[model samples]
Structure formats: C-alpha cells, structure tokens
Target: MKRYQFNEITTMQYIFLISGTQIGIGILSLPAQLADIANTDGWIAIVIGWIISIIASTIIIKTMEKHQQDTIFDLSRRYFGRTFGTFIHIAFVAYALLASITVVFTAIHITQVWILPNTPNYLIMMLFMLPGFFITKNGVRILGRYAEVVFYLTLWMPILIAVPLQKGTILHMLPMLKEGWAPIIQAVKTTVLSFLGFELAFVFYPFLKEKKHAVKAMVIANSISALTFLLITITCFIFFSPDETPLLIWPTLSLLKTIEFPFIERFEVIFLSFYLFVMSTTGIPYIFTTVFGISQLIGKKDHTIVLLVAVCIFIFTSFLYNPSFFHVQTLGSWWEKYGLWGAYFFPIGLFIYTSIARWFQRGKKK
Candidate 1:
C-alpha cells in the first residue's frame, strides 16, 4: 500500500498512453457511423471533429497547468464549492464507470461475433477484464508503461491493413462534398468519439515528469490519434463503397479479412490477437482512472484495494446489460451520446470555470 510520487512518467509515455487509449474499438465502427452522416465525405467530418477536439484539449491542459498540484477534483471543489464539486465528482465517477462498462460489453460483443461465436459471453468478458484488472492493480506508472508497449500493436495492425491499397479505389472518395458541408459537419460529431481518451491528460498530468511538457504531450497525442483515425476513415471509405462499409459490423476487421498474405490464409485471426492487446490498452486505463478517482473520493491510497473494487464493479456492470450481441450494439450507440457529453463537455465546462476563477484571483491581486 505504498503511495507513489507524482512526476514519474515521461511526456512521451503520456502521449503514447493517451493516443493508444483513444484509438480502441471506436475505430472499428467510426467509418460506418461517419458514413451514415456524411456519406462519402466522412473524412472531412473526421477533420472537423479533430479541430473541435484540439480546442477542447487545449482548454483542459491549460486548466491543469493553472492548478499544478491539484487534481481535477480539487480544482472543481475550489471553484464550484464543496457540495457542487462533490456532485461533479460523483458525475465524473458515474461517467467513468459507464464508459468502462460500455467498452467491456462492446469487447464482449466483438469477441462473440468475430472470434468466438460459441463461447459464452461472460467468459469473454472475464478474459478481457482479468488482465486489465491485474495491470491497474499494480499502479498508474505500470499501466502507462504497459500502454506504451501495447500501442505498437495498435500502430502495426492498421499499417498491415493499409498495405492492400491495390484493392482500394481512390475513385470511391470522388464527388467529394457532393452532399455539401452540413453532412460533413454532422459526421464529425460521430468521428470525434474516436479521440475521446485525450482528456485523461487532465488526470495524468500530475504523474508527468516534465509538467511544462504536459500540454505538448496532450497535443501530440491528439494529433497522432487524429491522423491515425483520419487514415482509417479515408482508407476504409476508399477501400469499400459507402454502402459496403456499413454492412460490415467491424469494418476494420473486415478490411483485414479481405487482405491476402502469401503465407497467411487468415490475416484476421492474427490481427484479432494483437487487436485484443490494443483493446486492453484502451480499456484498462478507463477502469484505472475510475478506480483512481473513487479512491481519491474515499481517501484511500492503496492501489490494490482500489483495483479490487474496480474489478468487482466491472464484473458486476459487464453482466448488468447482458442482452444479446445485437442489443449490445444498440446500447453502444445510445451510450455514445453520453460518452460525447462526458468526455467532451464536462472537461470544457471545468476548464471554463477554472479559467474565470483564475482571472478573478489575478484581478484581486492586481
């Protein structure tokens, strides 16, 4: 039950962890969701979404910088007062818990569909949650390092899928913006979900070794995530007809299945194994953050105890919404709207409050 010091993780590690967490299962469905809105101009939507994400992320980083020693919970209490801030913390914890549940269930659904049609869904949930719980049980620094390692698989899988450009038709993206700007802007809202994990920077800032470089890490993480997602969106749009893209549940996996390697008959089987690692990299941190925040709330500094509570919560919630696989998809779409609200708006509001409070304090000093 040792308490760890802040400033243990380097800026690069923070950037990589944030980018890795953001890029998870969202990438699989983004092309279809964006296409549903923007049609063939989904990539434009992704770009616009990235612009909004950048602005939001910048505000979050600046707010964290203003209160270098304090967590977001502390800042909220300072600005919003004790009662309101406690409510805000409860809201944050709820959002984090729901996000963890959504990801676990989504992973279970994906596994049931693509990998193990006959495997019991609960078993699949346990398989994914076990490693994540184990890692987070160690500490945040351990979790950050593990995320960096698994992130390589995240990069490699997409590159391997992208190698089949010969099968992709650049013409598929043609008649660009034929539907006009409104659809693209609408699509951007959906695509932006892929970049949601960058807000973790606010929570992780105190763990950064170079505090001044936190903002740089945040920007780099978002930029890399945006670029990776943009590539996926454009490549998928070009590779498959917009009509065909929506037909596939996991379009990225579908893309891998289409790829034929000289020695490999099924690229997807290999891809899924590595992709599971990437998915864990994305999911484990959300659970970790939730646990961390809860521990902070209850004044518990023991990582193992906090992690056990998180594991129990994940296990409990993972089953609470155990409808069939189709129901899981429906739940995901519904949960996504809340995801957007929690991940995007909550931090932005906090940033605004912190900024105004800082200005007032400075005015009083002057």
Candidate 2:
C-alpha cells in the first residue's frame, strides 16, 4: 500500500480556494431565482441570506476548531455513535456528488447555449472533467494553489462585464418588499442555496498549514463571496427588469451580452472565456470532495484511483439526464436545496450533539 502525505496549504490560498469554489454558474442565475421569489426585492433576500450564511459558517469554523485536526467525518463518528456518523458521512458524500454533477450539467448547458452549439454534450463534459480530475488527484494542496490562480479569472471577469453596465435605474429595485415579509423570507431560503460551498471549509480544514488562522480565512473567503454575489445580483436586477430577468436562463451572461466595449466587439465572448476558468475551479472541489469521501470510506490514501472513479461517476451522471437544459436545471435546483440541508443543517446538528456529549462526559469525569 502506498501512503500519500497531505501537504498543508496557506491561509490565503485556502481563502481563494473557498471563494473560487463557492462562486460558480450559480451566481449567474441567482438574481433570477431570487426575483422569482421576492421580485425586485430579491436583493434583500441575498443580504438576509448572507447574514444567515455567515452565522452558519461561523458555527462550522468553531466546530472544526474545537476538534482541531479531525475531519468532520471523524468528529461526527466521535460525537454521534459510529452508525449515525457513518450515515452522515454517506449523506455528505452524496450531497457532494450531486452538487458536482449539477456543476458539470450546468457547465455543459451553458456552453451549448452560448459557446459550443455544435459540440456534443458528452464531449464538452469530458473536456471539463478530465483536467479537474488530474489536478485533484495530485492532492488538495495542489487543488488549493490551482484554485488560487483561477480565482483571479473568476472574480474579475464578471465584474469586468458588469461594472461597465451601471447604466440602469436603481428605481427598478423600488416599491420595496411589495409582497411583504413572507416572500422575502422564502427568497432568503432560496438564496441560501447560492452560498453552498462555505461548508467545504470543514472538509479542507485539516489541510490548513495555519490552523490558528483558519477561521479568519474562512470568514474572509465567505465575506468576499457574499459581496461578489450581492453585487452581481443587484447589478442584474438594476439593469434588467424583474420580468426580463426570469425570462432569460442566464441573466448574468445576458447582461454581458448587452455590453459593447470600444475595443471589444462582444463582451459576452470575453465573459465566457473567463467563466470557463471559474467553472473549472468551482467543479474541482466537488470532484476533490467526492474523491476524498470515497477514499476515506474505502480506507485508501492513494487519491488517483479515487479521482478516476469520481470523474467516471460525474460523466456517467451527466449523461443520465439526456442533456435536456430544463431537466438539468430542475435537477440542479433540487440538488442545490439538498446541498444546503446537508452542508448547513446536518453539520450544525452534529455540532450541537458533539457539544452536548462533551458536556455530559465532563460531568461524569467530575
């Protein structure tokens, strides 16, 4: 048996890794989704969602800190019984797999719509998955560094396309909360799905070189991600009417399509090139988590086989839905909701259980 040692990644690199993973094609459709729920007041839901996400992320960080070097899987097994812990671990892996498939499906759908209309969906899916598998197989440290480099493309490209188009009316956002608090609260629930990847911090926590600073890094990464999503959501709502936003499949890209730079003929083309980089970063972590989860399950430390298995599963699942855009979107939405539950709710429950168990053990020791 070959043992592969895990390298510790820098706090800054981890920050970018977390941010890059969290911001994906989801950012593209979030305004439209929120609009569907809260109308023009959708941005309010985004703000509220961020507040909740921050609280959730803080709990995750604190829980990891209390356990120091233990992975969430180990902590779960220790806090809950082995049976319950194994169940939660399986749920985590399932959520990661579903999320990865959704990312691949969405990437293919976007490429088919915007860039490669003639390319077979499977071929495009292969192109995206292969590189991510190779990188993640190298290890999480490599993945974090690669994500750091890719983060620049992901962060700047959307802004480059969006910042120039600040020409729309802020009034479009007005008649605030017309549907009242009910819809705004529901929209906040929907918007929570967009903040899905913060919990990845739990999986990656053991690899941090500077464990003392991990919580700070996680906070910074999630804060930046929230601000970026908020800007994109607000920009889309301001530039396009609520009616126009939901009609278009990818509102962020649609907003870019309307921009014509002096030197650049089509801004959407520039946006697409950078968007691919973002997709790669976003998709790689899901692949890493899937591989990591399976490796832990089978007691294998060699990640190469795990990576290959993950790629095969992702490619196989991508084909399962017959490449229908609506089918992919619906499946993605369902998985996104499930991901929020697993990533946020399940882990928090484990944390509460762990705290109670520790308290009981202390009392018994006394």
Error of 2 at 115 (Å): 0.4
| lDDT tens digits by residue: candidate 2, 297-366 | 7788787887887678767865664468777878787887797787678768867876888899999999
lDDT of 1 by residue, 1-366 (tens): 112374277777888888888888898888877877777788887778788888878778888887676666676787888899888777777767667767777877787777788987667777887888788887778888887887764667667867766788998888988888988877777877778887777677777777788767778888888888888778888888988887776787777888886887877877887788877877887887788788878887775787886677666766665667677677677657777887788788777777788899999999
Clashing pairs in 1: none
Relative to the unseen true structure, what is the C-alpha lDDT of residue 167 in candidate 2, on a scale of 0 to 100?
83
TM-score of 1: 0.93
Q: Candidate 2: how large is its RMSD?
A: 2.6
lDDT of 2: 0.80
Off by over 4 Å in 1: 1-7, 316-321
Clash pairs (backbone) in predicted model 2:
none
Error of 2 at 333 (Å): 2.2
Best by lDDT: 2
What is every candidate's alpha-carbon RMSD to the true fold?
Answer: 2.4, 2.6
Error of 1 at 26 (Å): 0.8
Go through the candidates in order and give each one's C-alpha lDDT. 0.78, 0.80
User: Which sections of candidate 2 miss by over 4 Å?
Assistant: 1-6, 316-321
